[model samples]
Target: MTFQNIFFNSQAAVVVFFVLSGFVLSPSFFNKSINVRELAGFYVRRFFRIVPLLAVVTALSFFYVKSAFSTWKVPFANSWFDGVLAHDVPLSASILVKCFVGMNSALVPQNWTIACELLVALILPFLVKACTGRLWLAVLTFIIATALSFIAADGGGKSLPVVYAVDFVVGILTFRILQSHDKRYSDVFFYAAVIGLVGARNMLEVLTGQVDLPFNDPLLSLVEAIFAAVIIYGLATKNHMSRLLSVRWLVWLGDISFGIYLVHFLVIVIVARLMTSFLLPYSLPTQTFLMLIPVLAVSLAAAYFAFRFIEIPFNDLGKSLQRRVRTALSRG
Candidate 1:
């Protein structure tokens, strides 16, 4: 299939994820006025949710991924974080410190989004305050995110916190929209998903006319974010696709999605290597399809293990603590 023909999300998946984060978080985080303990609990859960697994993944990358893959030369300019989020320096302690603190550019390049996500989390309450019932604020956030997309392409945009903050705020807006209306789906909503899928699939090719896309184009990002929002919103609501999304297997996938996202790249590398080494298919698509199946399975399996072991335990602990805290507060 042509790149345009392929119905994959590519980079926009991250955008969708950020939107989903906002949508999922808005009701819970902003439904009522914020309180200190509530904010504290949010932070506690958010911290445990993101940091611990990230630290483990970073350590693995530093020790295993880096050491095992000689070809994995360090990415550009994540040089040193001695005292700044961005700077220049030697490589010796850079990866360790950068990856540990969730700074962008590391063994797992995808952590770029994680860095952005964490930054958004830091000011999420303020964002919630600004955006709740304020359509203008949400639109402003989207505009800012799009503007940053331009800066991103020019350079240093991806590392900037504002870019992802827009995405998370977009997510919050999605939740508000859902809450605004009943969680019902119209055929128009299905059409929305189709448009989103098409937009996501062919976005770069269509927008850039087969030319390279600038890193951060505000307009392009907004268009893509719209697609992402439609697709995610469709799945979340009771729409034509609701049954498919509601399937137990898919739900399970969603649960372990974090682990899969974190580990899937590594799995892909391993699986692709194994496929090329053994199968050596002639067709690129054939090779991709063959490896993709196993890569997904392996990634899912690894994620499941991690979810059950690392993520769930801590998540459950955080939830339990929050519950107790809530119970105590209610009594008081």
Candidate 2:
């Protein structure tokens, strides 16, 4: 793969995340005995798990945008990074509401993925039933999602939740389909799939060369989702790659990954601005390295604190509330 292809495909990571979400959450919905109360509890747990940290981070992001300059001219600047942090939307009641829902917020752009996750969570139980219970229904659901995605993209709503529901379904299917395969595959097969997934978009662009065929992007996304599912299977089945990933620090980072995603950009902007004096003389690479040291440190530290204090508490509270509701329902 080329340099840009290799390094610029972070969207691949997001695809993997969506598939992994489907696989992880499938177990609960895959339960044939999942009742209404239990499903409600799933929503409750998800809300607590996702929203508290998101809400806090969103608030911080809003205030940062409110107080900070419209454009921060940092040394060794990345256009993408600078552009993401540059915003001057006057904070009003409507803007706050939009930010809360992850609309029109440059500072917290990644929240759109979280919003999609929540949107898909609502229909996931039905999808589980469709996949597990009826092939025709599953196919129909996929078609609808694909059609909606096309309409959404064509109409300029690029990051709408509609675009990702199909990816989540791919994950659910991966979980269901892989349940039968208890056999191990060669590590070569796993690594090859990983490379393909990571570079899928770049390869597609090179091959297509401005050919805007209808449904092309959606089809490519499906291919990438399948690739991600294969990678997930390799890891879940404890392959060599999975073993390498199981190291203690890596696992801890995975635990706090959500917080890291939410707060890293904000941390980067603040840290970059603070270190501008030291960064002025260095080249881009050297400046990036210098910036990475403290950005990595502060982001990890901040994420850890947020995970420990905000995430765990809200998650536990959700569980506690869910238990109380179940108990009260049982008595009634």
Candidate 3:
């Protein structure tokens, strides 16, 4: 795909994720006291939501990319396999171990964000506490995150992870504003978000010489913060749009979005390989459409099973572990 094509399509879903993250994480921001047990449980749930699909995808990529069975007629060619697993760093044994520990390796390219999400989960409570439900503090947090992101970007590193944390912080701010229940204030933020999003692409293009600025542009952070605040406000208020977003199916998708995000890239790679090998007559768009049906079906099915069996069970286990640790510490 052309750079513009990829930028326009891929970034749309990412922007939605930023908005949804704020909407979902808002509840934690308003609580008077942070519950370590509850926080631990939440993180455990998130971990289970992401890790299983990640492991499967990574394993598949490793086997394919490393040419482990090259003598045999594998489903995909070696070049195809390498393309699927391409990353800045190689997928070596050490990297594979890191992948198991939630660090992304070449085996699953999109998993870089999973690492960031895990880090955000760890510090969310502290961030909420530090902001103290103040708008200025929220703004300050965003500024610091933006500065760090820019520094990282200028240093020739990916700063998307740092930039993404601004979304989480904005999520906390959204919760605070929701709890305040000030209609006028909420309206202002909502409008601001809409305006910012509408102009963000253009602004970033002007500032960074790219249609989509990955992390360097400060305006992109502003856009994220506004987008997050708008989603949070919508979730908190009763409105037509909020009702649409809250529809059972969409909410269900939102619930499983973590799994969807983690698994979708692997699905795409597999589908691409299949199409190439089979000489599928379907055009790219048609193939993409056809591919998504099964991908969504299988991914959602997997997510539902994981949510029911692994995610829920592991969450309870984490809670139990946290309780036991806390009790032991108290006794000591």
Candidate 4:
């Protein structure tokens, strides 16, 4: 894929993720103190929202490639299994143990982010409680975490945890801005975010050796900060931009976006492999584009179905569990 297409399709989607996350989590952030019962309920809901659908996708992947299973090897070998069990079914049981402990080696690669998101949710209550609506401190923590991630990057996986953390914190910050009803700052941030994204693309190109640059690291950092700030601002404001984001369709996409993101990669990879197997004569980019069409259609359809059947039911179960626990604790 061309750099521009990749940037807009993937990187920009990540920015949208940050903004949507902020919008979703703003309420909890503004509460200042996390109600433990509520926090538990929220996490339970989130878990059900994600895991079942992921499990289904993982299973599908395994079945699709079951014949190839025996050929798989160590380290990156399970990448072939396609099914959730085989995905987690490591070359050995010791690997399986590690997977259970959140060192997940899954059939679906995108699941790494889900694991990170779950980790964030587990600690969110404490984070919200500690920050106590302090936006600056939350932002600072994100900056430090991101910086550490850059320093420790092992082909970008090391940075992902920090990036997700920043995304969650951006959500919290959005919550704070909304609670405070800070319009002016939101307006400024909105425009600044747009500018930052444009600049970041140029800087990323330089870092990737697609372009020349001086002082790339510091410039990239500034761009990221601006992008993050804009996301927070967009979610926080009541301006026209915010209203656009709140549009029903966009909001719906935002709601299921997590599922879409998780499932899309697998869909694409599977379809691409199938195309290659069938000896499709199309160029790589053309085939990639064609593959994406069905991938998007199928992934979205599956995600919606998953949201209705799997995510909703499990979420309700979590809430039910939380209520029962709360009642028992209250009596104690």
lDDT (0 to 1) per candidate: 0.66, 0.78, 0.61, 0.58
What is the clash tally of candidate 1? 11
Best of the two (3, 4) by lDDT: 3
Candidate 4 TM-score, C-alpha based: 0.73
Q: Write down the RMSD of all candidates, one decimal each.
A: 5.8, 2.8, 4.7, 5.5
TM value for model 1: 0.79
What C-alpha lDDT does candidate 2 achieve relative to the native structure? 0.78
Q: Would you give me the overall lDDT of model 4?
A: 0.58
Best by TM-score: 2
Ranking by lDDT: 2, 1, 3, 4
Q: How far is 155's C-alpha from truth in model 4 (Å)?
A: 10
Q: Which one wins by TM-score: 1 or 3?
A: 1
**Model 1 per-residue lDDT tens digits across residues 288-316:** 67777798788889889989899988888
User: Which rank order by TM-score, best down to worst?
Assistant: 2, 1, 3, 4
Q: Which whole-number lDDT from 0 to 100 does residue 160 have in model 3?
A: 59
Pairs clashing in candidate 3? none
Over 165-270, each residue of candidate 3 has an lDDT whose tens digit, in order, gives 6666666666666667646335556666665555566655777777545533445655656665675576568655666778898888776666666666666555
Q: Write the per-residue lDDT of candidate 2 for residues 1-332, one digit (tens) a residue.
A: 35654676656777788889988988876756667777777888888888888888888877777775535667577678767656665567886776676554555878678877888898888888776666688778767877776666654444566777778888887787777675678899898998889778766776887443333266567778889988888888889999999999999999999999889888988888888888898888798889898999999999999999999999999999888766766676
Expressed as tens digits, the lDDT of each residue in 139-170 for candidate 4 is 67657756654554444554455555655555
Q: Which ranges of candidate 4 are over 4 A from the true structure?
A: 5-12, 15-23, 32-39, 68-91, 94-102, 133-164, 184-192, 204-222, 245-248, 273-279
